[model samples]
Target: MTTRSDPVPRTVPPGMADGSSGGTVPARRRRRQGGERSMVWLYVSTLVLGIGLWWLASALGDNALAPTPMEVVAAFGEGVRDGWLLDHTLASLGRVLVGFVLGVALAILAGFLMGWYRLGRGLLEPWVQFFRTVPPLALIPLVIVFLGIGESAKVFVIFLAAFLSCVIATFQGVRNVDLTYLNAARVLGAKDGTIFLRVVIPASMPYIFVGMRVALGSAWATLVAAELLAAPTGLGRMMQAAQQFLQTDRIVVGILMIGALGFLMDRLLLVAERRLTSWQEVR
Candidate 1:
């Protein structure tokens, strides 16, 4: 039997020769580590400064305006143990989620129709523009009158907030689809529906995701305001109640919780965006 010739070994790149190689000094790894360390120190400094200021402020007599961090932490613990915080947080989250889903879904459908059909766009664009100009909170009274001061009214406010932001984004995304790509697909005998699903939507996905991020923020804001106004339960209600009793600690706790939750939601959305748009973004 004849022996086959072995393939040549691939040459190692220039950065691998020295003991101090790219693996040991990776730019990306260094940057990430540096960033994490910086963030940690920044947060620690902020906490220290905040605590010191609060201590000084309390000594000067104004706990109402600047309660200590420890007080806030204790209140948070109390609220958690007593189910005050969790109940409200969960209720607010539920409304936000339902409204956000409905709004985004409707926005996507409306965006597709507006983008693909000129007659539809002409008919609906004016109405959309008018509604978009009107703030969701501005519709609070009208919604309360129409839907009552129930869950539906609160959710409707959040829905409108999310819908307006997302619809504009989706419409822009669809319109931003490359004409050449659509033409190529059409030449290949692709129907409008096929082109929309395969080409237009994929191209618009990045923008839609951007819209989702914005809509989530808008939804959160609207939910809080709506809940503060009329809801029987929610973080906003907790804060409002705290204000009524002048419980600065509870108010602080609510504010902190909202901030933390918003931060987490934003991070989650960013992760989703990165995963979904990996093809378009650099690895």
Candidate 2:
């Protein structure tokens, strides 16, 4: 009796064995790393270009309305030496932190309730929409009058700004959760609470984070305006005082500081987003 010879096993080439070699996986990783490094260089280049242009314009114009980068740097140093910068920055940071925390907490709670329950939506959505249309800055005068020109007034203005932006974002996020996920959970005999906690919250986190980022920007803008109008001490107040005397360098310093702080806060939130939403594909 003749038996069929066993077929010889096919051999995969090195690197191609797991499909990781043929310049596929490693190439992609290299490309990603290269892209990140390029982005950093681009950021630095743009910043340098911007500063160079500013310096050129200031030198050519020789105007009191604009100051050179060096002048602004000197002004910043002076402020630091006198402790003015530290005091104002700290005060502003404290107000922002307090207002942001309170506003985000309340907004998340309210948004979740409104998104989850039809009755809550019916009761809250119209009011929220109406108030959101009215700019947060418009409420500053009313807040100042009611709360007086104190820290409370400034914090309240920031809180309103953050709350309005965040609540809307979070509400939309919850409403946008995929129906498929909910149905699948129900099919698996999950209760409403379990489905919401396990599926809905995770699904909605991206939206919530987007809201938080927006709220931070709003809070900063509102804080500056509020401080400009009534605060005794803060970055806004510093800038306002500088403007009155045509202290252009100081004004530039304050503006730059505000922008730098806002940028830092946004970066922190982005880190948090990446950590919390690691399950979601980044790109």
The digit string of per-residue lDDT tens for model 1 on 198-283 reads 99988888888888889988998776788966678898998898889888888888788777787788889888887777668443
lDDT of 1 at 177: 93
Clashes of 2: 0
* Residue-level lDDT tens digits of model 2 in 1-283: 9886998787776657556767576666688789989988999999999998988888889566777788888999999999999999988888998898899989998899899999999999999999999998888778877998888888888998999989988998899999999999999999999988999999999999999999999889887887965778899999899889999888888889889999999999998998899788654
Residue 93 lDDT in candidate 2: 87
True-structure lDDT of candidate 1: 0.85
Error in Å for residue 231 of model 2: 1.5
TM-score for each prediction?
0.82, 0.89
Q: TM-score winner among the candidates?
A: 2
Runs of candidate 2 with Cα error greater than 4 angstroms are 1-31
